[model samples]
Target chain A: EPEVTQTPSHQVTQMGQEVILRCVPISNHLYFYWYRQILGQKVEFLVSFYNNEISEKSEIFDDQFSVERPDGSNFTLKIRSTKLEDSAMYFCASSEAGTGHGYTFGSGTRLTVV
Target chain B: AQSVTQLDSQVPVFEEAPVELRCNYSSSVSVYLFWYVQYPNQGLQLLLKYLSGSTLVESINGFEAEFNKSQTSFHLRKPSVHISDTAEYFCAVGAAGGYNKLIFGAGTRLAVHP
Candidate 1:
Protein backbone atom coordinates (compact mmCIF):
# COMPACT_ATOMS: atom_id res chain seq x y z
CA GLU A 1 0.00 0.00 0.00
CA PRO A 2 1.12 3.52 -0.71
CA GLU A 3 1.79 5.76 2.28
CA VAL A 4 2.48 9.46 2.71
CA THR A 5 6.13 10.21 3.53
CA GLN A 6 7.35 12.99 5.80
CA THR A 7 10.89 14.11 6.49
CA PRO A 8 12.81 15.06 9.62
CA SER A 9 11.09 12.61 11.93
CA HIS A 10 12.14 14.90 14.79
CA GLN A 11 13.19 18.56 14.84
CA VAL A 12 14.28 20.92 17.57
CA THR A 13 14.42 24.63 17.01
CA GLN A 14 14.78 27.82 19.00
CA MET A 15 11.81 30.11 19.45
CA GLY A 16 11.35 32.74 16.73
CA GLN A 17 13.34 30.60 14.28
CA GLU A 18 11.96 29.50 10.96
CA VAL A 19 11.23 25.86 10.21
CA ILE A 20 10.00 23.89 7.27
CA LEU A 21 8.44 20.44 7.53
CA ARG A 22 8.23 18.42 4.33
CA CYS A 23 6.01 15.63 3.10
CA VAL A 24 5.56 13.53 -0.03
CA PRO A 25 1.98 12.47 -0.48
CA ILE A 26 0.79 9.56 -2.53
CA SER A 27 1.41 10.32 -6.17
CA ASN A 28 -2.15 9.98 -7.36
CA HIS A 29 -3.71 11.72 -4.41
CA LEU A 30 -4.95 15.25 -5.01
CA TYR A 31 -6.01 16.34 -1.57
CA PHE A 32 -3.30 17.16 0.97
CA TYR A 33 -3.56 18.33 4.54
CA TRP A 34 -1.52 19.33 7.58
CA TYR A 35 -2.57 18.57 11.14
CA ARG A 36 -0.87 18.95 14.48
CA GLN A 37 -1.28 17.35 17.89
CA ILE A 38 0.04 18.97 21.00
CA LEU A 39 1.17 16.79 23.89
CA GLY A 40 -1.88 15.02 25.33
CA GLN A 41 -4.22 17.11 23.18
CA LYS A 42 -6.46 16.40 20.26
CA VAL A 43 -5.23 16.46 16.71
CA GLU A 44 -6.13 19.77 15.14
CA PHE A 45 -6.48 20.66 11.49
CA LEU A 46 -4.09 23.27 10.22
CA VAL A 47 -4.69 23.46 6.51
CA SER A 48 -5.93 21.60 3.48
CA PHE A 49 -4.39 21.71 0.03
CA TYR A 50 -5.68 20.70 -3.36
CA ASN A 51 -4.56 21.65 -6.88
CA ASN A 52 -1.40 23.21 -5.47
CA GLU A 53 -3.30 25.79 -3.43
CA ILE A 54 -4.65 25.85 0.10
CA SER A 55 -8.37 25.26 0.08
CA GLU A 56 -9.04 25.77 3.75
CA LYS A 57 -7.22 26.64 6.93
CA SER A 58 -8.03 26.80 10.60
CA GLU A 59 -7.66 29.71 12.97
CA ILE A 60 -4.46 28.16 14.28
CA PHE A 61 -2.95 28.62 10.83
CA ASP A 62 -2.36 32.29 11.30
CA ASP A 63 -0.01 34.63 9.47
CA GLN A 64 2.91 32.74 10.97
CA PHE A 65 2.11 29.52 9.15
CA SER A 66 1.85 28.66 5.46
CA VAL A 67 1.68 25.56 3.29
CA GLU A 68 2.79 24.92 -0.24
CA ARG A 69 3.09 22.19 -2.78
CA PRO A 70 6.47 23.52 -3.86
CA ASP A 71 6.96 20.78 -6.40
CA GLY A 72 4.73 18.24 -8.03
CA SER A 73 5.63 15.77 -5.34
CA ASN A 74 6.65 17.81 -2.31
CA PHE A 75 4.11 19.33 0.07
CA THR A 76 5.53 21.48 2.82
CA LEU A 77 4.42 23.45 5.87
CA LYS A 78 6.54 26.42 6.89
CA ILE A 79 6.50 28.35 10.11
CA ARG A 80 7.71 31.91 9.70
CA SER A 81 8.39 32.44 13.39
CA THR A 82 8.06 29.52 15.70
CA LYS A 83 6.95 29.85 19.32
CA LEU A 84 7.50 27.52 22.22
CA GLU A 85 3.84 26.58 22.12
CA ASP A 86 4.36 25.41 18.54
CA SER A 87 5.91 22.19 19.77
CA ALA A 88 3.80 19.31 18.56
CA MET A 89 3.62 16.32 16.25
CA TYR A 90 2.85 17.57 12.75
CA PHE A 91 1.26 15.13 10.35
CA CYS A 92 0.70 15.17 6.60
CA ALA A 93 -2.11 13.36 4.89
CA SER A 94 -3.50 12.74 1.39
CA SER A 95 -6.68 11.47 -0.15
CA GLU A 96 -8.15 10.92 -3.59
CA ALA A 97 -10.75 13.10 -5.27
CA GLY A 98 -14.52 12.58 -5.69
CA THR A 99 -14.73 9.71 -3.31
CA GLY A 100 -15.11 9.05 0.36
CA HIS A 101 -11.82 7.20 0.37
CA GLY A 102 -10.05 7.47 3.68
CA TYR A 103 -6.79 9.37 3.84
CA THR A 104 -3.24 8.07 4.10
CA PHE A 105 -1.01 9.73 6.65
CA GLY A 106 2.74 10.01 6.96
CA SER A 107 4.78 9.26 9.99
CA GLY A 108 4.65 12.64 11.73
CA THR A 109 7.45 15.13 12.27
CA ARG A 110 7.84 15.91 15.95
CA LEU A 111 8.56 19.61 16.14
CA THR A 112 10.00 20.93 19.38
CA VAL A 113 10.33 24.70 19.67
CA VAL A 114 12.64 25.51 22.50
CA ALA B 1 -19.54 23.15 11.30
CA GLN B 2 -18.74 19.71 12.65
CA SER B 3 -17.43 18.35 15.91
CA VAL B 4 -16.49 14.91 17.18
CA THR B 5 -16.65 13.60 20.70
CA GLN B 6 -14.75 10.63 22.04
CA LEU B 7 -16.27 9.71 25.36
CA ASP B 8 -13.40 7.73 26.82
CA SER B 9 -10.01 9.24 27.36
CA GLN B 10 -8.43 5.88 28.08
CA VAL B 11 -9.50 2.25 28.18
CA PRO B 12 -7.49 -0.56 29.73
CA VAL B 13 -8.30 -4.14 28.77
CA PHE B 14 -6.59 -7.48 29.22
CA GLU B 15 -5.26 -9.33 26.23
CA GLU B 16 -7.95 -11.10 24.22
CA ALA B 17 -10.60 -9.02 25.89
CA PRO B 18 -13.26 -7.15 23.99
CA VAL B 19 -13.14 -3.38 23.76
CA GLU B 20 -15.31 -0.51 22.66
CA LEU B 21 -14.40 3.13 22.12
CA ARG B 22 -17.39 5.45 21.92
CA CYS B 23 -17.49 8.28 19.37
CA ASN B 24 -20.22 10.80 18.65
CA TYR B 25 -20.35 13.60 16.11
CA SER B 26 -22.46 16.67 15.36
CA SER B 27 -22.68 18.25 11.96
CA SER B 28 -25.02 20.56 10.14
CA VAL B 29 -24.50 18.79 6.87
CA SER B 30 -23.97 15.19 5.95
CA VAL B 31 -20.48 14.10 6.92
CA TYR B 32 -18.13 11.21 6.57
CA LEU B 33 -17.06 9.37 9.68
CA PHE B 34 -13.57 7.99 10.16
CA TRP B 35 -11.45 6.25 12.74
CA TYR B 36 -7.70 6.73 12.80
CA VAL B 37 -5.13 4.98 14.91
CA GLN B 38 -1.75 6.10 16.19
CA TYR B 39 0.66 3.58 17.53
CA PRO B 40 3.58 4.36 19.82
CA ASN B 41 5.56 7.28 18.37
CA GLN B 42 3.93 7.21 14.95
CA GLY B 43 1.51 9.13 12.78
CA LEU B 44 -2.23 8.68 12.36
CA GLN B 45 -3.29 5.79 10.18
CA LEU B 46 -6.79 5.42 8.74
CA LEU B 47 -8.37 2.46 10.52
CA LEU B 48 -11.79 2.52 8.87
CA LYS B 49 -14.52 4.80 7.56
CA TYR B 50 -18.27 5.09 6.97
CA LEU B 51 -19.03 6.67 3.62
CA SER B 52 -22.57 5.96 2.45
CA GLY B 53 -23.59 2.53 1.35
CA SER B 54 -23.33 0.74 4.67
CA THR B 55 -23.65 1.92 8.22
CA LEU B 56 -21.18 -0.70 9.36
CA VAL B 57 -17.51 -0.70 8.44
CA GLU B 58 -14.60 -2.97 9.27
CA SER B 59 -10.85 -2.73 9.12
CA ILE B 60 -8.48 -5.40 7.94
CA ASN B 61 -7.53 -5.95 11.51
CA GLY B 62 -10.24 -7.34 13.72
CA PHE B 63 -12.09 -4.06 14.30
CA GLU B 64 -15.51 -2.79 13.34
CA ALA B 65 -17.57 0.36 13.75
CA GLU B 66 -21.26 0.97 13.41
CA PHE B 67 -22.53 4.31 12.22
CA ASN B 68 -25.72 5.24 14.03
CA LYS B 69 -27.26 8.11 12.17
CA SER B 70 -29.97 8.63 14.75
CA GLN B 71 -27.55 8.76 17.63
CA THR B 72 -24.79 10.34 15.56
CA SER B 73 -22.31 7.80 16.89
CA PHE B 74 -19.60 5.69 15.34
CA HIS B 75 -18.25 3.47 18.05
CA LEU B 76 -15.31 1.17 17.36
CA ARG B 77 -15.37 -2.37 18.66
CA LYS B 78 -12.99 -5.28 18.62
CA PRO B 79 -14.11 -8.69 19.75
CA SER B 80 -10.70 -9.59 21.09
CA VAL B 81 -7.69 -7.30 21.11
CA HIS B 82 -4.00 -8.04 21.25
CA ILE B 83 -1.09 -6.17 22.73
CA SER B 84 -0.34 -4.88 19.26
CA ASP B 85 -3.68 -3.10 19.35
CA THR B 86 -2.49 -0.85 22.11
CA ALA B 87 -2.64 2.66 20.70
CA GLU B 88 -4.57 5.90 20.56
CA TYR B 89 -7.77 6.02 18.52
CA PHE B 90 -9.25 9.18 17.10
CA CYS B 91 -12.67 9.84 15.65
CA ALA B 92 -13.10 12.48 12.98
CA VAL B 93 -15.70 13.95 10.69
CA GLY B 94 -15.34 15.45 7.23
CA ALA B 95 -18.11 17.44 5.63
CA ALA B 96 -19.44 16.21 2.31
CA GLY B 97 -18.13 18.94 0.12
CA GLY B 98 -15.10 20.00 -1.88
CA TYR B 99 -12.76 20.81 0.94
CA ASN B 100 -12.20 17.73 3.05
CA LYS B 101 -11.03 19.53 6.11
CA LEU B 102 -11.54 17.23 9.06
CA ILE B 103 -12.76 17.89 12.59
CA PHE B 104 -11.21 15.50 15.07
CA GLY B 105 -12.11 14.46 18.59
CA ALA B 106 -9.84 14.09 21.55
CA GLY B 107 -8.34 10.64 21.20
CA THR B 108 -9.06 7.55 23.27
CA ARG B 109 -5.96 5.71 24.38
CA LEU B 110 -6.38 1.94 24.34
CA ALA B 111 -4.02 -0.02 26.52
CA VAL B 112 -4.06 -3.79 26.19
CA HIS B 113 -2.46 -5.65 29.05
CA PRO B 114 -1.20 -9.21 29.25
Candidate 2:
Protein backbone atom coordinates (compact mmCIF):
# COMPACT_ATOMS: atom_id res chain seq x y z
CA GLU A 1 0.00 0.00 0.00
CA PRO A 2 1.16 3.56 -0.72
CA GLU A 3 2.08 5.62 2.31
CA VAL A 4 2.93 9.25 2.97
CA THR A 5 6.63 9.93 3.30
CA GLN A 6 8.34 12.75 5.20
CA THR A 7 11.92 13.90 5.10
CA PRO A 8 14.24 14.82 8.01
CA SER A 9 12.63 12.55 10.54
CA HIS A 10 14.25 14.55 13.32
CA GLN A 11 15.25 18.20 13.38
CA VAL A 12 16.99 20.26 16.04
CA THR A 13 17.13 24.06 15.91
CA GLN A 14 17.80 26.97 18.19
CA MET A 15 15.12 29.35 19.17
CA GLY A 16 14.30 31.97 16.51
CA GLN A 17 15.65 29.72 13.79
CA GLU A 18 13.71 28.65 10.73
CA VAL A 19 12.66 25.12 9.81
CA ILE A 20 10.98 23.38 6.94
CA LEU A 21 9.28 19.96 7.14
CA ARG A 22 8.65 18.19 3.90
CA CYS A 23 6.24 15.44 2.91
CA VAL A 24 5.19 13.56 -0.20
CA PRO A 25 1.60 12.50 0.05
CA ILE A 26 0.03 9.58 -1.79
CA SER A 27 0.28 9.78 -5.55
CA ASN A 28 -3.41 10.33 -6.28
CA HIS A 29 -4.46 12.09 -3.08
CA LEU A 30 -6.07 15.52 -3.49
CA TYR A 31 -6.39 17.11 -0.03
CA PHE A 32 -3.43 17.60 2.27
CA TYR A 33 -3.08 18.63 5.91
CA TRP A 34 -0.59 19.38 8.65
CA TYR A 35 -1.02 18.47 12.31
CA ARG A 36 1.14 18.67 15.42
CA GLN A 37 1.33 16.67 18.64
CA ILE A 38 2.88 18.03 21.77
CA LEU A 39 4.60 15.49 24.04
CA GLY A 40 1.50 14.63 26.03
CA GLN A 41 -1.26 16.44 24.25
CA LYS A 42 -3.74 15.68 21.54
CA VAL A 43 -2.91 15.96 17.87
CA GLU A 44 -4.01 19.37 16.67
CA PHE A 45 -4.76 20.48 13.16
CA LEU A 46 -2.57 23.24 11.79
CA VAL A 47 -3.70 23.77 8.24
CA SER A 48 -5.33 22.23 5.19
CA PHE A 49 -4.33 22.73 1.58
CA TYR A 50 -6.16 22.06 -1.65
CA ASN A 51 -6.00 23.32 -5.18
CA ASN A 52 -2.67 25.07 -4.53
CA GLU A 53 -4.24 27.20 -1.81
CA ILE A 54 -4.87 27.05 1.89
CA SER A 55 -8.42 25.89 2.41
CA GLU A 56 -8.44 26.47 6.18
CA LYS A 57 -6.19 26.91 9.18
CA SER A 58 -6.40 26.80 12.93
CA GLU A 59 -5.49 29.38 15.54
CA ILE A 60 -2.31 27.43 16.15
CA PHE A 61 -1.33 28.14 12.56
CA ASP A 62 -0.25 31.72 13.13
CA ASP A 63 1.82 34.15 11.12
CA GLN A 64 5.01 32.15 11.59
CA PHE A 65 3.61 29.05 9.94
CA SER A 66 3.01 28.48 6.25
CA VAL A 67 2.46 25.52 3.93
CA GLU A 68 3.23 25.04 0.28
CA ARG A 69 2.97 22.40 -2.37
CA PRO A 70 6.22 23.56 -3.91
CA ASP A 71 5.98 20.83 -6.51
CA GLY A 72 3.15 18.64 -7.69
CA SER A 73 4.34 15.85 -5.42
CA ASN A 74 6.02 17.71 -2.57
CA PHE A 75 4.19 19.39 0.29
CA THR A 76 6.05 21.38 2.90
CA LEU A 77 5.48 23.31 6.13
CA LYS A 78 7.80 26.16 7.06
CA ILE A 79 8.17 27.90 10.35
CA ARG A 80 9.58 31.40 10.03
CA SER A 81 10.74 31.51 13.65
CA THR A 82 10.83 28.54 15.88
CA LYS A 83 9.99 28.94 19.53
CA LEU A 84 10.73 26.57 22.41
CA GLU A 85 7.05 25.76 22.53
CA ASP A 86 7.25 24.69 18.91
CA SER A 87 8.94 21.43 19.90
CA ALA A 88 6.61 18.67 18.83
CA MET A 89 5.90 15.98 16.27
CA TYR A 90 4.66 17.44 13.01
CA PHE A 91 2.61 15.13 10.82
CA CYS A 92 1.51 15.39 7.21
CA ALA A 93 -1.60 13.66 5.96
CA SER A 94 -3.54 13.26 2.72
CA SER A 95 -6.88 11.89 1.65
CA GLU A 96 -8.56 10.80 -1.54
CA ALA A 97 -11.39 12.78 -3.18
CA GLY A 98 -14.22 12.54 -0.72
CA THR A 99 -15.66 14.47 2.18
CA GLY A 100 -15.65 11.48 4.49
CA HIS A 101 -12.74 9.48 3.20
CA GLY A 102 -10.10 8.25 5.63
CA TYR A 103 -6.72 10.00 5.57
CA THR A 104 -3.24 8.51 5.44
CA PHE A 105 -0.62 10.12 7.65
CA GLY A 106 3.14 10.26 7.29
CA SER A 107 5.65 8.98 9.80
CA GLY A 108 6.02 12.53 11.13
CA THR A 109 8.93 14.90 11.60
CA ARG A 110 10.05 15.48 15.15
CA LEU A 111 10.93 19.15 15.52
CA THR A 112 12.90 20.28 18.54
CA VAL A 113 13.26 23.99 19.16
CA VAL A 114 15.87 24.53 21.80
CA ALA B 1 -15.87 22.80 16.05
CA GLN B 2 -15.62 19.08 16.83
CA SER B 3 -13.75 17.41 19.67
CA VAL B 4 -12.67 13.84 20.45
CA THR B 5 -12.33 12.33 23.89
CA GLN B 6 -10.42 9.16 24.67
CA LEU B 7 -11.48 7.90 28.07
CA ASP B 8 -8.46 5.85 28.96
CA SER B 9 -5.03 7.32 28.62
CA GLN B 10 -3.40 3.91 28.87
CA VAL B 11 -4.50 0.31 28.54
CA PRO B 12 -2.40 -2.64 29.66
CA VAL B 13 -3.13 -6.14 28.51
CA PHE B 14 -1.37 -9.45 27.95
CA GLU B 15 -0.65 -10.85 24.53
CA GLU B 16 -3.64 -12.59 22.95
CA ALA B 17 -5.98 -10.77 25.34
CA PRO B 18 -8.89 -8.70 24.15
CA VAL B 19 -8.74 -4.94 24.48
CA GLU B 20 -10.91 -1.93 23.88
CA LEU B 21 -10.08 1.74 23.63
CA ARG B 22 -12.99 4.02 24.33
CA CYS B 23 -13.60 7.14 22.26
CA ASN B 24 -16.28 9.76 22.28
CA TYR B 25 -16.96 12.89 20.27
CA SER B 26 -19.01 16.05 20.45
CA SER B 27 -20.58 17.42 17.28
CA SER B 28 -23.90 18.90 16.45
CA VAL B 29 -24.07 17.77 12.88
CA SER B 30 -23.10 14.51 11.24
CA VAL B 31 -19.38 13.94 11.08
CA TYR B 32 -16.80 11.43 9.94
CA LEU B 33 -14.99 9.29 12.52
CA PHE B 34 -11.57 7.67 12.32
CA TRP B 35 -9.04 5.67 14.33
CA TYR B 36 -5.32 5.95 13.75
CA VAL B 37 -2.38 4.14 15.30
CA GLN B 38 1.16 5.40 15.81
CA TYR B 39 4.09 3.18 16.54
CA PRO B 40 7.09 4.65 18.34
CA ASN B 41 8.63 7.55 16.41
CA GLN B 42 6.18 7.09 13.56
CA GLY B 43 3.28 9.03 12.12
CA LEU B 44 -0.33 8.10 12.59
CA GLN B 45 -1.58 5.18 10.44
CA LEU B 46 -5.18 4.65 9.49
CA LEU B 47 -6.72 1.80 11.48
CA LEU B 48 -10.32 2.14 10.38
CA LYS B 49 -12.99 4.74 9.70
CA TYR B 50 -16.75 5.22 9.85
CA LEU B 51 -18.13 7.42 7.11
CA SER B 52 -21.38 5.80 6.05
CA GLY B 53 -23.21 2.53 5.65
CA SER B 54 -22.75 0.06 8.52
CA THR B 55 -21.52 1.53 11.76
CA LEU B 56 -19.13 -1.31 12.39
CA VAL B 57 -15.82 -1.21 10.56
CA GLU B 58 -12.96 -3.70 10.74
CA SER B 59 -9.31 -3.42 9.94
CA ILE B 60 -7.21 -6.16 8.43
CA ASN B 61 -5.24 -6.56 11.63
CA GLY B 62 -8.18 -7.76 13.70
CA PHE B 63 -9.01 -4.28 14.98
CA GLU B 64 -12.55 -2.97 14.82
CA ALA B 65 -14.57 0.13 15.72
CA GLU B 66 -18.23 0.92 15.95
CA PHE B 67 -19.77 4.31 15.27
CA ASN B 68 -22.62 5.11 17.62
CA LYS B 69 -24.38 8.32 16.74
CA SER B 70 -26.64 8.27 19.77
CA GLN B 71 -23.77 8.20 22.26
CA THR B 72 -21.35 10.05 20.01
CA SER B 73 -18.85 7.23 20.36
CA PHE B 74 -16.44 5.32 18.09
CA HIS B 75 -14.57 2.87 20.27
CA LEU B 76 -11.91 0.52 18.87
CA ARG B 77 -11.46 -3.11 19.84
CA LYS B 78 -9.22 -6.08 19.15
CA PRO B 79 -10.04 -9.61 20.14
CA SER B 80 -6.42 -10.74 20.42
CA VAL B 81 -3.60 -8.22 20.56
CA HIS B 82 0.01 -8.90 19.87
CA ILE B 83 3.19 -7.33 21.20
CA SER B 84 3.45 -5.63 17.85
CA ASP B 85 0.14 -3.93 18.56
CA THR B 86 1.66 -1.96 21.38
CA ALA B 87 1.38 1.65 20.27
CA GLU B 88 -0.53 4.87 20.66
CA TYR B 89 -4.04 4.98 19.25
CA PHE B 90 -5.94 8.14 18.45
CA CYS B 91 -9.56 8.78 17.64
CA ALA B 92 -10.59 11.77 15.57
CA VAL B 93 -13.70 13.55 14.39
CA GLY B 94 -14.21 15.72 11.34
CA ALA B 95 -17.01 17.57 9.70
CA ALA B 96 -18.30 16.04 6.49
CA GLY B 97 -17.34 18.92 4.26
CA GLY B 98 -14.64 19.97 1.86
CA TYR B 99 -11.93 20.84 4.33
CA ASN B 100 -12.27 17.73 6.48
CA LYS B 101 -10.01 19.16 9.12
CA LEU B 102 -9.69 16.67 12.00
CA ILE B 103 -9.85 16.98 15.78
CA PHE B 104 -7.94 14.24 17.58
CA GLY B 105 -8.10 12.81 21.06
CA ALA B 106 -5.20 12.82 23.48
CA GLY B 107 -4.50 9.20 22.53
CA THR B 108 -4.41 5.88 24.38
CA ARG B 109 -1.16 4.03 24.76
CA LEU B 110 -1.68 0.30 24.47
CA ALA B 111 1.01 -1.76 26.14
CA VAL B 112 0.74 -5.41 25.22
CA HIS B 113 2.57 -7.54 27.74
CA PRO B 114 4.12 -10.88 26.91
Error of 1 at A106 (Å): 0.7
Q: How accurate is candidate 1 locally (lDDT)?
A: 0.92
lDDT of 1 by residue, B44-85 (tens): 888998988889899999899999999999999999999999
lDDT tens digits, residue span A1-114, model 1: 888999999999999999999999999988999999999999999998887788889999999999988889999999999999999999999988732676788999999999
RMSD of each: 1.2, 1.2
Q: What is the lDDT of residue A33 in candidate 2?
A: 94
- Provide the clash count, candidate 2: 1
Poorly placed runs, candidate 2 (over 4 Å) = none
Itemize residue pairs with steric clashes in candidate 2. A107-B43
Going through the candidates in order, their DockQ values are 0.66, 0.76
TM-score for candidate 1, residues paired by index: 0.96
The positional error of residue A10 in candidate 2, measured at the CA in angstroms, is: 0.5
Per-residue lDDT tens digits of candidate 2, residues B1-114?
A: 788899999999999999999999999878999998999987788888888899999999999999998898999999999999999999998888665788899999999999
- Expressed between 0 and 1, the share of native interface contacts present in candidate 2 is 0.82
